[model samples]
Target: MASLSLWLFSGLVLLVGLERVAELIVSNRHASWAFSRGAVERGQGHYPVMVVLHSALLVGAVAEAWLTDRPFLPALGWTMLVIALGSQALRWWCILTLGNQWNTRVIVVPGLPLVRRGPYRFLPHPNYVAVVAEGLALPLVHTAWVTATVFTLANALLLTQRIRVENDALRELAVMS
Candidate 1:
């Protein structure tokens, strides 16, 4: 059980690291295009803090999973794994759809229209769905219910602000379209 926890934590850390790298690359590309297009950036204050909090949640989940060694039902682990994978898929889909537009920060491309196709056609915030799924199930995969519950509650609060910023930015873009 301890070994599993270590491995799970390590894998998650690596996954997050890679995701950050992707975000940086995408943001750099977006920056060049958006600036050239005279896009104004709005509400960037909470972005860095949010990134830190999200990373902390991943690390905390890993720690809790590693420190505790309660035997989890195999069925539960499998179910959580499935949910986690689903969340990852959703996240990657968002990344693909947004391309250079997808950023971890609050970057607004003034003249560009808000995305309404793909998953966005349904959920206004498909990224939020991915976040919720991840916050709930990632820790559960290792039977770290404590981590899951606490992080989910925290993320809910943080997401409220995040969504508000995103909505405002998108709304600004919507006026032109």
Candidate 2:
């Protein structure tokens, strides 16, 4: 049962990784669109770090689950799975709402109006909310508590800096407009 659960969890991680690839494809296209509109990218320094940490998150969850022989508690696992799925939904909502304005990098086109639809209607950084939820829920889906803990802490710090850069860029855009 434990091995089967591990295999299942591994498959889940792979699917999520594939989803990330799809996101990157979309993000690249959107980035090109933004650049054509004279987008100014800020916070380049943290982009690679963000990529590494997110990749590590998937790897860590699977490694920890396999290494520690973590058993799937149906109660916790199912609940976490739902939350993780919900987070994905929220992330896609953000992407679709932002449309061509969205990129994995903080590339904001000057003179473009701010987005306030979908999840953004409620929160200044709704995508980060999805990120936080996924960081916690994905690992917990297979009881990778250590991965969940470390990722949550690291992501919180990353987001603190990330949000500041984003807000600064937005403020600049507002001032320009």
Candidate 3:
């Protein structure tokens, strides 16, 4: 049963990784569109680090689960699974709301107004809320507590910098407009 749990968790991670690939495809297309509109990208230095950290998150979760012989506590696992799924739903809502303005990179077009729809209507950085939830919940789904802890801390730091860059760019846009 424990081994089965590990396998199931592995499958879940794989599916999430595939979803990331799909996001990248959409992001690339959106990026091209933004560039055509003379968008300026900020925080390029952190982009690769963000990619590596996120990729490591998936790998580390599975590795920690398998290496530690982590057992799935049905109560915790089921609850976390729901949270993780909810985070994904929120993330997609962000993407759809931003439409062509969204990219994995912080590319903002000058003269465009900030999006105030969907999740953005409530929180300024609603996508980061989804990201934070997923960072913790995904690893906890299989009781990868160490991975969850490390990722939550690292992601918090990264997001601090990311939000600053985004806000700065948005402020510049506002000033220009």
Candidate 4:
């Protein structure tokens, strides 16, 4: 049952990984389009590093799940899945809200006001909220609480810098607007 659970959660991780890849691809394309058309101020730093870190969460989660042989608890997995699914929805809502303004990279257009609509209207960092939720839920899906704890802590540390960079870029754009 534990190995079966490992396989199942690994599959779920793969599905989410594919979705993340698709998101990255689309974001790259859209960001390129926006940049070419003079829609953003490009703040190119360690974007690829962020991508790598994000992918590593899945790798870590899967490893922890399989190696630990975490027991199968339907309630835990189902609850985590629910949170994970909700975060995905909120993430897309963020993408839609930002429109062409959004990118995995920190590219803020000069003279354009920071998007204050959709998810942003309520939270200064809705996408980060989604990310934080995801960082927690994905590991919990497989009952890999260690992964959940470690990844969440690591992500929080990374986001500290990331969010500052994003905010600085957006603040510049907001001033111009």
Q: What is the C-alpha RMSD of each candidate to the true structure, in Å?
A: 2.2, 1.4, 1.5, 1.9
Worst 10-residue lDDT window for candidate 2 reads 168-177
Once fitted onto the true fold, the runs of candidate 2 whose alpha carbons sit more than 4 angstroms away are: 174-177
- Provide the TM-score for each candidate, comma-separated: 0.87, 0.97, 0.97, 0.91
> What does candidate 4's lDDT look like per residue over 1-177, in tens digits?
457778888899999999998888878887787778666544456666677779888998999888877876899999999999999999999998988777788876666767778988899889999999999998999888988898888888778888888888777665533
Residue-wise lDDT of candidate 2 within 1-177, one digit each (tens)?
458889999999999999999999999999999889888999999999999999999999999999999889999999999999999999999999999988889999988878887988799899999999999999999999999999999999999999999999988974432
Which residue pairs clash in candidate 3? none
Please report the TM-score between candidate 4 and the true structure: 0.91
Q: lDDT by residue for model 3 over 1-177, one digit each (tens)?
A: 358889999999999999999999999999999899899999999999999999999999999999999889999999999999999999999999999998899999888988888998899998999999999999999999999999999999999999999999998864432
**Clash counts for all predictions:** 0, 0, 0, 3
Task: Give the RMSD in angstroms, all C-alphas superposed, for model 1.
Answer: 2.2
Between candidates 1 and 4, which one is better according to lDDT? 4
The lDDT values for all models are 0.77, 0.93, 0.94, 0.84
